[model samples]
Target chain A: MRPRPPAMRTKRRYILARILPYGVQVDQKQMYFAVIEAATSLFGDAAVGLAQPAVVFCEGGYVVVRCRRGAENDIAVALATVTSVADERIALRTVATSGTIHALRRRMKPSRRHSGDEEVKIGETYFAVYRYPRQKVDLVEKGIKHQKSLFFTEADLEER
Target chain B: MKITDAGIRPYPAGDSTVARMALEAAGLGFDSAVAIGDAVHRPPGIEILRGAVIGAASVKEVLKRVRDPAVRRADIVYVDAGDTSFNRAVVSIKEVNVVRSIHAARRNAFDHVAARTAAEQGVAVDISMAPIIHLRGTKRQRALQRYADVLSLQRRYGFPLTISSGARSILGQRSVREIRGLCALFGMTGTEVTEALASVGWIAEPHRPVEVVK
Candidate 1:
């Protein structure tokens, strides 16, 4: 009898996440461990195994994680639950999810920068702000030589 | 589409100070946060609403406290769901804005009757993330299951639902998107999560005038 070919595997989904503190980079192994630990802690071992998560790529503050098709949300939740990587406090924000890497990469193009200076008031003091990213902001206070950082998001800027 | 965290306890009341906690919550992308403590100075660019969590052993005590001049003046009123009767009583009251920790009990806390009453009375149900973050092992599993059951009832009965961080400190707060993602585990869709977050605005002041008559 002829040898049978290996069974075809089910298709998977890839999630693109941007690690916070923008410049901090982590390796594939560390990223994979952090995700697995987070999923295990949140959903337990059986679900994590069922999700079949894998780190396909990790570099330049971005990570692509693959998981079983139906478990994309579970994996995304797990990724969000991760608060630390390599003993440092960090956050993984899901930028996009796709069925193929090409599409996800296209969707990950850099957003246009907002120019011109703005003023932000924190408590009783006011600071001159230069740039504000999704996680952190660059600000300069009066009479201060060094710039101070304040982390804020678009939702924080709304006046309710 | 204002994102609000309706259940945060600032320092002296909880863990971190009010200003620091609000700053962290704002940094996490919330437009407003209800500080469940005594009066605290508000932060710039963020709306800080005052609220109180009242836990009582009986219905009479809850009613008496709710009618008190000090308690009546709060922007939001959350009644702790301690027992089945208490839960039913709180949900049926039109003055009560939220029934907090409905899943804290070991088993299903509210039933179909309670759900219908809450929906009719315009009372919202809160699923606090605190217990899930604090509990472990089988206890955590049980809590999640209970939360799922409550969510199903909310879907069937059409009561307003709010998913809150129930955070005591700065580190405990999650971004609006993060909260929606976590809620996905409980079977809430993206639209449903947005609605729940938006529901906070209405539930905080359900009877407010939409526009001035004059």
Candidate 2:
């Protein structure tokens, strides 16, 4: 069967969003489920079905969501409502929206660790520290699973 | 107008420090954040205003709580909303800047009377994005219903409305654009969100007639 002509094809819009906390690996399928759940709950099944939202790319701490052109705003709103993906607490900060994936890619700024990783102890618990620019520091309690995370600054660490 | 987050719990209350939250807030497009606890660090880029939360069963108790030195020293004061009569009485108090957590209050708790009193006393009702973002199913529905009711009352009575992220951690902090979107879930317009973000500034330093310094 021949594909539909370019003019007949459905117009699409892509939204780029940065996942907060800088470095949590996200499964694309799980991210899709999370997005669909949020959109359906907020806008109802009918509206979400019409919008046809899908997660096309989830990498480099950024995600590109594809949806119908007219539904980008509603979809972006739904993206903001996404609090977690696969039980991991997170936030999707919408960076930009465009007609093509290439345009959205230009907005992706890959997050890099600013300094060497280290360990610190407060009380009996130990935490692994990950440093970033702007004096931002993230501490993950040393554990095999469900580790508690703490957000602080360089000054906060010094005082501790 | 300075865009201010009406509520944030930093340091001992949460994992993030006040300075760290301030840094995140600056990147999220806020000029100031109201730290609702014992937060001492004052970050340079974004303003951190000391805030005190009063949870009381009676107006007399609220009055007593605000008199504490810590509460008195706070740049802003918030009260947890209670039932209808309690809400009406709390809004008229001069020291209270915002009535927060109205989403948890029962239906019609913040009625026309409370709105009018709040408007008259310059007390703003806080609309937090936490419920819309974090809650699901029946709880989220109830929160939306309450916010919608409050929005209608605010429109009719012309009372000031304030928007807060209610963030305890930097991960919970959202950008201004995201906040506008979350607020839209409850029928709030972009213009309304902007005004709500700026209402904290108004509450801090209300417009008044100038007096001669001489």
At residue A33, what lDDT does model 2 achieve? 98
lDDT of 1: 0.74
Candidate 2 on A27-129: residue-level lDDT in tens? 9999999999999999999999999999998999999999998999999999988988888888898999999999888888879876436899977899999
Candidate 1 true-interface contact recovery: 0.11
List fnat per candidate, in order: 0.11, 0.89
lDDT, candidate 2, residue A121?
A: 91
- Position A50, candidate 1: lDDT: 90
Predicted complex 2: CAPRI docking category: high
